[model samples]
Target: MLVSFRLPLLNEEMDINDAAGIQALLEQLRSSQAWQEAVALPTAPNEPNIVPEPEESNSAPSASVAELLSQLRTEPDTSTLDRPSEPTPSLPKPTTPATPHLTPLTPTAPTADLSDLSRHLTFQQALPVIANLSGNPNLIQTLKSVRVLLTCLLELMFPSQMKDEQHALETRLMEERKAIVTKYEEKVKVAKTKASMIGSGMSKHEASMLSGAFHKELKSFDTERVLTAWDGLVSQQQDALSQLGIPIMFASTEPSHRESQQKVIQVLEGLL
Candidate 1:
């Protein structure tokens, strides 16, 4: 009887336990006559003598391969070849690196012209302009013009050091107004004190009488005299401005005079 055995080929994917079983199976076959015959088979005389050189395999096996060989050698069981192997846990997939976020730069605002700021200047703005122009010979005309304009505006607004007649008239009118207010205030205070002493019964009637007297005094107060004094003060300022060649029109209505003054200020500001 002819005996034949089929052997499976070993590959990298074969489990270490399975490889050990295959190695044991090969050992069993080594004692068989057919294995002995196959190993003793003679080569033809013309065929080259093939020899494996240790120097050709001088390079070491990779770590994975060495580790597989180690596992196979350590395992003693051959029956495990018939059993199913535990599945290997899969490795996580590599993630793409996140792109870095960048904040966009803000564009700068346009620079404003220095001269454009003069449009909204108050009377106090003159001081800085005067200080800057001082000691500069080339700006003498500008300095003089600004000084005169500022002086005119100040005199028109405050009206100090009036002519002898105008000053006396204003003083007299102010005194009269003060006297009227003082007299009424004194009377109201007396009436309030008396009512408080006499109790609430007569307080209402006293308050009504005081109120009437106060209103009568206020109505009698000469507002026309104060207006006349102001008009005289303005007339004096107009004369002063004319002497300085500022030529503010006192004869014009209040609104017209204000408009003219604004025009003059604009012209003076342009000179700077």
Candidate 2:
């Protein structure tokens, strides 16, 4: 097929009849200054070269090729394909307030008194008081009786300082002592009234029987009965005091126990 072209500048007609002629025409046009100027005509700053297809070809670049060229011109950002894209910005999550931890406190036990305990007046110092109160000149027996009295009184008054069983025992013994004293007092009153009736003309046989009954009652309700009960109570109390770790046997023992005992004694003394 023969392709004809009229050159505007040279005012000549050329025909490309074969491949050789087309090659020769391309070489001639590349060397010409006029062709060079037309080829160098700038279309856009950054764009692909778009040369028109030959008029002899029935297919004008396919739809795919045109679409591809359009995409290349529109979307020029292709450098990001090799490198990774920037991460999208994310919103920070809402923060929650922290709860505070609380600690519990322990309660302290009550402390004993000090100023009143400084007087140093306890059952140990009760020798003179005992001698005067009982009118007993025998020092040895009096001191022994004082200790027994002190032990019984200390446990009875300060049951809080003793063990549960010891405290219960002391409570029972004290209640028993109270009952004995009450019974003794009632018996004494009745005996005194009966003695008053002896001289009021009662029969001799009845008088003799009353006298024998009074003697028997007197023997039964004597100081020995109360003393026997107190002795037993003191023995138990001494054991209880030893179990409690209180060194009350001697005046020269642990001063802390003595001080605590003295504190309680001072309060009792004040009450007395």
- The whole-model C-alpha lDDT of candidate 1 against the native structure comes to 0.49
lDDT of 2 at 152: 32
lDDT of each: 0.49, 0.45
Query: lDDT per residue, candidate 1, 1-272, as tens digits?
Result: 22343334323234445667756644654555554544344545986544212223222222222333343444434568767787898888999989989889897765863333432344355446545544455444432432222222332221234444454765788798888878878877877677678784446777688778876766655545565555556555555543433333233336555565555545444545
Q: What is the lDDT of residue 231 in candidate 1?
A: 58
lDDT for model 2? 0.45
RMSD of each: 23.6, 18.6
107: Cα error in model 1, Å: 71
Show model 2 residue runs off by greater than 4 Å. 1-156, 160-200, 204-212, 250-272
Q: Please, what is the TM-score per model?
A: 0.33, 0.24
